[model samples]
Target: MRNIYFVRHSIQDLSVQDDASAPLTKAGNVLAKELTRLFINKSITAIYSSPYARAFQTVLPTAEKLDLIIDTHADLRERQAIWRLDWQEHLANLWQDFELKADGEESFADVERRIVPAFQQIYDDTEGDIIITGHGTALSVLFHHLTHGQFTFSDWQNMNMPDVYIGHFSDENVLVGLEKIAR
Candidate 1:
């Protein structure tokens, strides 16, 4: 059995102008340390994160502790352009219709197209337990893809900042178990 851990980035400072540049908040920093503690004993073989600053910050403590370099993937970023002007409306629109995309924004299918392949590549290439720090929407899509759309928007809504999603995979690329842990 191989396990992949997907951790949503910790709380972020919402005051930043650029969402991609937003760093973790003080509480988020503390949570990062706690995240390190949670995984220190898990024998994580590799660590990966979104290119976003918040996600990178969330994984830093653990990566440092484990002496593993954190690899980044652009597709792991949150649903793009949702953080742009009238982002709340954009987010609502996204949930209402996964196909909706504003200029420069990504539809759910677009996100899935990029994210799922990266996730699959990681699953196929990696050995032993792995950790990937990502955003809410992208991670949700990945879970939905892995479970053949068994996961839903409600599951995405229920996800917490810094939540831990554990996926257990068989040798045949079948998902045996999917568990979510809130922190």
Candidate 2:
């Protein structure tokens, strides 16, 4: 069994108002510290993160503890918008706008394309546990893909900041189990 841990980056300071450079807030920092402690005892063989500051920040503490430099993957960045819209208005139309791909952002399908290859590469190269830190919406789509579309929006809603999901893959690359980690 191969174990993959998908961890959402901690709470971002939405006050930043920028798309790419938002940093983690004070609460996010606290959460990262706690997550670091939780990860310290585990055998994490590889650490991968999105290029975004917030996502990198979330994995930094754990990376430090493991003395492993994070491997940044551009494909892991948060979903990009194909069109510019007011952030608040975007939130209101989130699930309703299936055709509304943001101008500068990647659509959900775009995210899936990159995410699958990233995970596949890791699975091919590693025999032990692998950890990935990324954004919420992107992670949600990833979870759905990993579980073969068993996860849904309601499942995404139940997840909290720094949430961890475990995926167990068989030798044939089929997912055997997809479960949320309580921690």
Candidate 3:
């Protein structure tokens, strides 16, 4: 059995000018530091993060503590198509016509394509524990897919920033257990 820990990036300050480039705020940094302590005893094989700054920032503390470099993956990024638009517009359209817009950014489906493969690659490459730092919506989608579409955003939103979900994968690469971390 392989254990996969899916972690949401720390809180981002949207008040900053660049939303995508927004690094972790003071609160986020503090939270990440605390989360790092939890991993001190665990053997985190690798750390994977989204290309976005916020996601990377969230995992930096843990990576630094473990003396490991974070591996960036484009598929681990947030829903890109919604990212380019205004927050309100993005939120409204996200529930409806995500793929209809003709933009270069990625939709939920596009995110799945990248994330699923990345997940498989990670599972294949390592046998112990793997940690991934990603955005909320993208992580939610991946969680849904991992659990055979039984998990939903509402179920995952309960996980706060830097929260971890422990998943068990079988020999066939099927996710068998998804236990939410309560912190």
Top model number, TM-score: 1
Candidates ranked by TM-score: 1, 2, 3
Tens-digit lDDT track of model 1 for 1-183? 888899999999999979899999999999988988778889899998999999999999999999999999887888776346776566666766778897887898888899988888877778999999999988988888888878877888888888898999898888998999655
lDDT of residue 70 for candidate 3: 94
- Give the Cα lDDT of each candidate: 0.87, 0.80, 0.79
Tens-digit lDDT track of model 3 for 26-90: 99989988888767888888998998899999888899999989998877888765345475456
How do the residues 2-23 of candidate 2 rate in per-residue lDDT, one tens digit apiece? 7778889888998897867999
Worst 10 residues of 2 by lDDT: 91-100
**Clashing pairs for predicted structure model 3, backbone only:** none
Residue 83 shift from truth in candidate 2, angstroms:
9.5
How do all models score by TM-score? Answer: 0.91, 0.86, 0.85
Q: Model 1 scores what on Cα lDDT?
A: 0.87
Checking candidate 2 for backbone clashes, the offending pairs are 80-105, 80-106, 81-102, 81-103, 81-104, 81-105, 82-102, 82-103, 83-102, 83-103
Candidate 1 Cα deviation (angstroms), residue 11: 0.7
Model 2 clashes, total count: 10
- Ordered from best to worst lDDT, the candidate numbers read 1, 2, 3
Model 3 residue 70 CA deviation (Å) reads: 1.1
Identify the runs in model 3 with alpha carbons over 4 angstroms from their true place. 83-105
